[model samples]
Target: MAKDNSRDTGKNTIPKKKGRQSAVCANPLYPCAMTGAASALAGISDMGVIIHGSSGCYYYADMAVPDTLHSTFIVQDEVIFGSAERLTEIVESVSKLYNKIAVINTCVPSVMGEDIKEILADYDTICVDAPGFIGYFDEGWRLAVRELADSIPINNSNSNTNTNTDAPLTDLSKDSKGNIRVNIDGVCSMDPFHKGSLIEATRLLNLCGLKTAAVFCHDTYESITHPSPYSVSVNPDYNCADVMNRRLNAGARNSTDSLLGPDNVLRTFEELSDRLTDTEDAEIDIDISKIESECEETDEILTKEGDRYLRRHDPPRVAVYSTYAYTEFACDMIANYMDGEIVHAAARNNPPDSDLNGGENPYNIGGICSLHRIKEILSKKDFNLIIGSSFEHAAFPDSAFVGLTFPIRHRKMLYDRPVAGIQGALYLMDEISETLENGNKKSN
Candidate 1:
């Protein structure tokens, strides 16, 4: 369990009462950073993940990852001597099953000062120091990527020449056939929406005649081992500084918005099209036209369903608590499909750079929200539709509840369904419309 980074500031002079709200699904008392780190590593197929800690730590992380994982179960005796021998055994076991391995450090082994790097230095391995107590889930995920980034081999001929120069290490474009293939970043299989997000991204990319080189951290180990000079980001939080499309960083519109709606699908094509400078202009337009036609059909279906929804039920006052992209997308669905308004929003990860919570922006409710502070805000609002984790759903039993975030016990779906892109927006709106109709509320 990670400690709350916030210290007990001066005590509030006035005490507040715990309101009569329904007991929402309770969050785990303590969230583990190790779980996030372990899950990230497990997403890569054929990559063996060794959780370096006690068996219990292995169990906890395995609950999230669920496959192709190794555990160094350092017993009490081994703790007294060292975990080196046990780790060696685990590595040997995993090496046979996997071509590459990642050593994820947990609290026990990390605290005990195990020589993990030294022991695995010669092997195809990267050691990510992701002790649970150090940070939160976001930090842990980024740390794992950073650690792997440090160890990833660049096969550029200019690698030696650039080593001593003042140039940045990440700029290996000289060796890259940039824009030939696309790498989709930030949709990890560990996320509740990972599978669906990846599927949608692949579909959208393929629609534009783009060949996917790799879906970073969500594909087989063989796929992720290689690097591309460019990638399209599904989430803004993922580090895109190295291989991201720089041409897309224009002042046309907010970058985050380009990850949410049908317009975003078009934007992605446009951006990637610019990078495909070698392609004939006529050919590029043809590809873009094909993708745009698909979105048009999607829009037609959604618009028809949305019209029926407006006729069937009153627009529910909605509030969303999730990532910025998820929140904004849900808001778009409601306003377009159900004619509803988002009364409030709480962003779980990085705060949005756009006008999500501004008065003019119908898509938002609050300025910025964290997991720690969102509960209080949700309790005070009068929203009838709540889109977020099980916790928020529990708080608003009377509201039209939809779970878009994680730890949702009631609905466990394995199918690929994106909350972004043309299909994603339509799917989410259909869910919202159906929930409203079935929840015994009618305008007629």
Candidate 2:
């Protein structure tokens, strides 16, 4: 058994004010818990995820998740009587196709309380009770990760000892060539930048002489069950490293870092490089100089580009709305690189930590959720640019818009564009500059 160093933080419980009956009931910007659970589980290529609920639940989850999904499609009769038989039939069929089956219980079936575990006792299936009323997308995602963590087989063969007392523990999984592999967490299939961010993070890891071991919910069941001890995240909100470490006893040290912004990317990689080299038994040589050089070059390019944009037009006073991590990153980029002012920054979900801005929130208002609240804020604020999803664009169609969040219906994103590593910083800045310039021209 792995070491259990986890304390009861009550971090998983849903907040009272942010529940289903909250102000976000009307025109909720983010998806519900069911969709979030499906998105996380469906990302596993080998696992067959079944939404054990009505057609509406199944369709909504299927639409949001890019990967293949299954459903029991419980009808009116099943609701009144019981969904156990219907669920069993689907699980039986799906069991043949996949190595493992995961059933996500939606609102109706969850309320039925028919003992899903007992019904699927004969088959190899994992049941996750993530109803729509539980919480928002992030809540559902975390619940699924917690459930998955239970299935991960603990490996006692790997030693958790650190030779260098000053250095952080580096008991990470390695690849065929003996390179330390790092797991990339927070890559959900529903997010538009998922593909691009995954590629960018992998590229940066390779540049620093590290291999990508497992993508949190995106990789295979085998890979996900056996994750690397060391991890880095593209988005901090959907991160599962802490949960994994807490659940698993062996090599369960917190070695995850965030790579959301330019500064975070540089800092995270630098720290990772230092930890690897500090290990006395670490034979694989890592060179972080190349990463530093590339980041510096990218920073110089961003400064020049930002300066060029500022010469033609006034800095864009923007309203940013996304997940907390993304919202912060957008606000930072606009303010730091473009010298723009953030009029308002709204997070779709709650902040991961207590500190909303680390005492540097440039925006007048922060931490507001729901489309109703956002609309109210937009009515008062005067801003040239809006950074969010289609909901924001629809509400304020006249504003200069950049689709950074989900439900991006205005434009078709055929290419896998990133928003994470050095390339990600460049791509994001490029988009912001072009959008600002175009919006300025239209206004003029």
Candidate 3:
């Protein structure tokens, strides 16, 4: 990136527009490309991220990401004289501390145009060009992961010996052909429900006689040599594992659909069953039975207890503030559990409206969605039981809320709780049920 020795105007700048619809709502609560890169890099246990920008820029990005980020405070003097020497000094100093390092270029340093590759040529580091203004979080993280894939030679040399030797890819390739070797791709440990999602996918696969080879971002170590040809991505947006799946040999399923909602999650496992076994009818039957049982258990609890609560007090209007995929997923589950209608749903990031319509309205409202926009919609259409992150929870203190996304800091999560699969759907039913019952008790 070129180094510019001038006043930076775009660091926290949000271009003003005519209305809420017209307003440039590029940066929401979600991370920019730089933050996504930094946060994603931090998931590599002892990996360190060096933010190549001003302290102010670093601070804002650092807030959402839990990892401790490294930064050489670029002052006015360094910006004027060029901070090449200073940046190298910090990189050298910080390199000894981490097993790996990612130098992330934010808006300021990117505009300044520092040739980082030449500077860090000698060090064991990966320089990522993730200008904050260029893209959103999804794009940023993909670039970082892509860079990680390109630079980090994942050969047997530095392979984590500690990695589970239960289902070695070499042995599976030779013996089983493709019976059990499965890798869960896309869902990184950076996500709030990532750990839980990993556990659920592995658990479901194991139940169906499938042995998970590895989870790309969550797994111990990923080698340059593709471990397993067969792979599944948890998020449709995430493509790190998908890219590797293309080069895989025969007898591999390279589908990259998300397991965000229960329906898709069920389909993901079914797809795996088919790939692993030629005659998977028995396995599919057993899997379907388990899912049916789980759904039944949720229904019994809600029907017996939930109906009583609604009888005493009117069902509250439901509103979900989440991503498009997650919103659809949660809305489906909520509709199944509650009699009350889903009045409103606001997406943090929207996939084009043309695609969403599909000749039918999914009722997704987006575009520079601020607190005011949310309130503006809510005033016209009253809602109850807000389902989203802590931000929405704080905004609607009067309404019953559930932690569905990020900033779930206050809630004490005992186990790795999921919000995706059968268990996740049941968990939501339980949470909503409890909230309803409690509200009834208070009212009585």
Q: Whose lDDT is greatest here?
A: 2
What range of 10 consecutive residues in model 3 has the weakest lDDT sum? 4-13
lDDT of 2 by residue, 144-207 (tens): 8888887666665534312122333444456556568888988988889989999999998888
- Candidate 3, residue 269: how far the Cα is off, in Å: 1.7
Highest TM-score model number: 2
lDDT of each: 0.61, 0.77, 0.60
Runs in model 3 lying further than 4 Å from the true structure: 1-27, 97-99, 152-179, 186-190, 220-227, 232-239, 247-252, 278-315, 352-361, 365-369, 409-415, 440-444
Candidate 1 error regions (>4 Å): 1-31, 157-180, 239-259, 278-286, 352-375, 395-398, 440-444
TM-score each candidate. 0.77, 0.89, 0.76
Given candidate 1, what's the lDDT at residue 52?
90
TM-score of 3: 0.76
For each candidate, how many residue pairs have backbone atoms clashing (under 3 Å)?
4, 3, 8
lDDT, candidate 1, equals 0.61
Weakest 10 consecutive residues, lDDT, candidate 1?
Answer: 13-22
State the lDDT at 310 in candidate 3: 67
